[model samples]
Target: MLDLALEIAAELIRRPSVTPEDGGCQDYIEALLQPYGFRRIRIDRGGVTNSIFLRQGERAGCLAFAGHTDVVPTGPLIDWPHDPFAAVVENGMLHGRGAQDMKGGIACWLAASIRLLRDGVPIPTMQLLITSDEEGESIDGTIHIVKHLQSHGMLPDAALVGEPSSHRIVGDTVRRGRRGVMQVRIRFDGKQGHSAYPQDADNAIHRAIPALHRIIDLDWGNPAAGFPATTCQITNLNGGTGASNVIPGHCDAFLDIRYNPANSADEIESMLRNACNAEHVQLEFDRVADAFATPDGPFLDSVTRAIRDTMGIEPRLDTGGGTSDGRFLAKAGIPVAEIGLTNATIHQIGECVALEELAALSAIYASLIRNFEVNG
Candidate 1:
């Protein structure tokens, strides 16, 4: 299983599939799963890339493993010891793009799925969901795959996202939920006029300042919403010309928001508009991901038990981090838990994964699959 995991991981990192690009990584994944008996479901709706592969066991429910095949672009190649897509392994550390950030998790998970298939003992249906977009402009990916599933009347009983979650020793931590993410791009308008004739035109900068401060300072996170104290951050603000004397005609600010599940995207937008009482302000929203919380259900317990059995540690369920594909599944109303290698080096230049952890994760996943749908 470890060999298979490494093979898959190395094969993937070699593909160089940066965000919004498949780079044939999806093809490789589908081919690898085909020999293992999983049926692939392709979904290409309006330029989005997503696929779901399913393997059924005769058990009473369904279990899913989800991951993104995309990796964030390697910022600058100079800092890396070798090519980011090289997938070089040395001294027990595998280094490459997506090595720690997550291609490793996907590989380990696929290995487990194959192992479960080899066992040939009937269990619940198992699905593998892999997407080609996650690191940028996530316009499609998980949500699209899920929408396709919903349209086809196929939803899972539970899911496990192979996102990098462990912080220290493998299995020491597992993220059970994630905070929601919301962003707004607002444009404020005012009549253009000369600097000396400021009275002739309303300064959009002046008109927008008070409202921007209010919205930026507004607490978006609410306890009842199951999140930390929500706060809004203005990422970009522009209003003035090169000439300091000119009072710009238009002001624009980009806002990013992360809240909890209790508030809908529409509610957050309304809240922002109401708080930002600027006249002629235009708002555009992006990927308003809702928060997710996986209850202590059968699937959660199975993962915990699997971790303890494999790694000799009791895992913790946490809910506080940036968004992931897990939110997509949670929105689909499936109970989910996360388990994987330490994330200390994720998205870093070296981005490596511990070999032993990979083995342990595969073991844990296999154990969980065997025990899946079992009553507590």
Candidate 2:
């Protein structure tokens, strides 16, 4: 099983499928699963590749493993110890761009499923929800797949997202939820004039400082249980012209907010707009991703039990992360759990994963599949 996972992971890493590009990764996956009685359903849209590989089981329920074939861009080839797309294995590590972030997790899940089938183990109905639009603008990614499944009444009983959620070791942590993201762009208007002529020119920077201070001081309210407090940060600010003597006509500031379920996007927007009450200020808000959580229940218990039984350690149920496609599934009423390899080197120059970690994760996934049962 470990050797099969390593081979599959290496093949996926060598594809160079940057965000919004599958680079034939899905084609390879289809070929591998076709012989195992898995049927492929394509949901390609807006130049993004999405696929659903399904295999009917002799058991009672359907379980899905959601993942992405896309990887973030490798910063620079010269800075990496090995070629980012080479998928080199040395010193017990597999080095490549998607080695830890996602492709490795997908490979492990595939290996586990195949191993179970080969061993003649009866498993639940299985689906592989794979997309290529995760690391980019996720407009037409898993949401589309989820919508299609809903229309056809084919939603899975539960889903496990392959997002590399472990912080230190495989099976040590699993993210049951993620904080939502909201971004705001504020532009303050003022007349451009010489800095020396304060009376003739209204200083945009002067107007921005007090307003921004008010925004910074606004209260976002208490966080929900088992989640972090909402955080708002001024990520970018620009006001002055190239010439020191000129007062800028416009000042732009960008706010990135990560809010929990306690606060809605509507409330956050209202707070920002009310704080920046000046007549000349214009605000643009983008609700990038909505916050989601899966309550402690049978699905989570089964996953944690599998981890504990496989690795002899209890997995921590965490709710910290940027965002993921799991939010889409969670919103659609599917119990979601994110369990994968350690994410220490994800999106880094020398991104890599230990071969041992891959084997352990594969074992956990196989256990989960073998013993999975849907609870009402």
Among the numbered candidates, top lDDT falls to 2
Model 1, poorest ten-residue lDDT window? 220-229
For candidate 2, the TM-score is: 0.85
Per residue, candidate 2 scores C-alpha lDDT tens digits across 1-376 of 9999999999999999999999999999999999989999999999999999999997999999999999999998999999999999999999999999899999999999999999999999999999999998888999999999999999999999989999888999999999999999999999899989978998898889999999889898888766899999999999888899999889999999999988888999888989998799999999888999888799999999999999999999999877888999999999999999998999999999999988999999999999898762
Question: What's the lDDT for candidate 2?
Answer: 0.93
Per-residue lDDT over 114-150 for candidate 1, one digit per residue giving the tens place of the 0 to 100 score: 8777778566788888888877777678888888878
Give the CA lDDT, 0 to 100, for residue 72 in model 2: 97
Clashes of each: 1, 0
Residue 133 CA error for candidate 1 (Å)? Answer: 1.7
- True lDDT of residue 193, candidate 2: 95
User: Relative to the true structure, how large is the alpha-carbon lDDT of every model?
Assistant: 0.81, 0.93
Q: Which residue ranges in model 1 land beyond 4 Å of their true spot?
A: 45-49, 75-79, 184-226, 233-256, 272-288, 374-376
